[model samples]
Target: MGRNVLVVSTVDHADDTLRARIGDDVDEVRVVVPVVQQGFMDWLANDERAATHAEEEAARLEEELPAVSDARKGEADVLLAIQDALATFDADEIVVALRPDDETQFAERIAQEDLRPSVAGVPVRAVVIHEQG
Candidate 1:
């Protein structure tokens, strides 16, 4: 048995980057791609486009990372998604990938400070990665 890590990110995690952040002894990795609703209108529209993008991103990550135990769509809010995942996925650690702070402040913008309180006990690692071009 090994440690199970939960990866919550908005971008496609490259192999090197993922390895660097996740470190060693990761027996299982469950990925959660957060659906980011663009605007209030998108939210009112049920965020169909956002949901589609999230699923596509999750699928891409799943294909890119063969060792991944599971990959699925998560809520628009990253914190909520982590909480939701923790309910079902037994995660020993959590790695959150986010855009740089200087980047646009989207709804999903989260830092280690805000994340730590939401998920107590479970250690969290946040990586500042640029969004894929």
Candidate 2:
């Protein structure tokens, strides 16, 4: 029998082919998505004036968008969350399916961590799923 596998997804969308492959596996598979806080959602959906201002601010920081300290902290938090979620499941592997063009920081974070040891022996494979045209 196949071992359990967990899929961490930043987006709800997964292509049909990949989904089919996942379903074909005999082991259990679970998909986990990060929840956007209400405040963050509101910021994203702000009025035209606010949205423009926010965009301008972000653009201004493009040169140094993610400082090393901040990036490390975010990755650590994600690692902990992933650990907690996998705590109860008997997973033999973890497949992280992230969008190629996503602006979210999940992919970068996971790529920086040591998956095998962090997962307590469960092998982890990070797969970047680029959207098909």
Candidate 3:
């Protein structure tokens, strides 16, 4: 059996860096895109925009990877989504793809060092994915 990889990202999909990092060693890939609430008012209103975007993001990611086993929207918080995803995916490796040069609070939440200790001690790899407009 090959490695099961779990990816959590802010962008639409995992980039070439991911492929280069792991090569063709991937057996199964699960990509989760977090639905970040834009602001307090949007959170209160339960806006669907964020979720809609995440769903689309996950779909695009699924389309990109041939080994993708699962792709879906995760919790609003990226870290929470990664934690919850692990409960079911049983991934051997975890990849957190952060959109570089992003100034959003969502980007700030992902700390490679901090995320490493969690995820049941799985090796964590952080990669920069530049989102295209």
Candidate 4:
């Protein structure tokens, strides 16, 4: 059977890289991002003080012609759902695409997760990509 590869990336740009590396070897490419949902919920479920703060920031950014905070609740939700999806999908291998500099730190975070050890038992590969100057 072909390898079921899980590609965990912090940014969507990694999708291109995954397509390149995954060429023929991987039968499927699943993306995992683990922060998107929690951040949005924490922002959305704000108490009076926090909501006011967010509104002020949003206004300030707009007045300054800065970018608006786009609603990425879905992305965040997907990120927070990583472990669950991993179990559900039964991926044979995990290919973590990280910047070379942050590769160690990212791996460390995964190792620290409660579910990581069991998941690690199934082959996990970390693919670090060097950044261009």
Candidate 2: worst-modelled 10 consecutive residues by lDDT? 66-75
TM-score for every candidate vs. truth?
Answer: 0.82, 0.51, 0.79, 0.48
- Candidate 1: where are CA atoms >4 Å away? 13-15, 110-113
Candidate 2 residue-wise lDDT at 49: 41
lDDT of each: 0.74, 0.44, 0.72, 0.44
Model 3 error, position 24 (Å): 0.8
What are the per-residue Cα lDDT tens digits for candidate 4 across 1-133? 5666665543324445655665566555455543421233453563344334434432332232211122111122323344555665667766555454453333324432433423535655555565544
Question: For residue 13, what is the lDDT in candidate 4?
Answer: 43
lDDT of 3 by residue, 14-132 (tens): 55666666668789999988776355566557569878988988888888765988999887766678888888888898887776654344323432225554467777777777666
lDDT for 25 (candidate 1): 74
State residue 64's C-alpha deviation in candidate 2, in Å: 39
Task: Kindly list the per-residue Cα lDDT of model 2 for residues 1-133, writing each as its tens digit.
Answer: 6556665543324434335444554355544433221134343463344334333432332223221111111112335545765776666676655555454444334433444533676766666666555
Off by over 4 Å in 4: 36-82, 102-120
Instruction: Provide the global lDDT of candidate 1 against the true structure.
Output: 0.74
Please give the clash total of every predicted structure, in order.
Answer: 0, 0, 0, 5
Give the C-alpha lDDT of model 3.
Answer: 0.72
Error of 1 at 75 (Å): 0.6
Q: How high a TM-score does candidate 3 get? A: 0.79
Q: List the residue pairs that clash in candidate 4.
A: 33-79, 34-79, 36-76, 37-76, 37-77
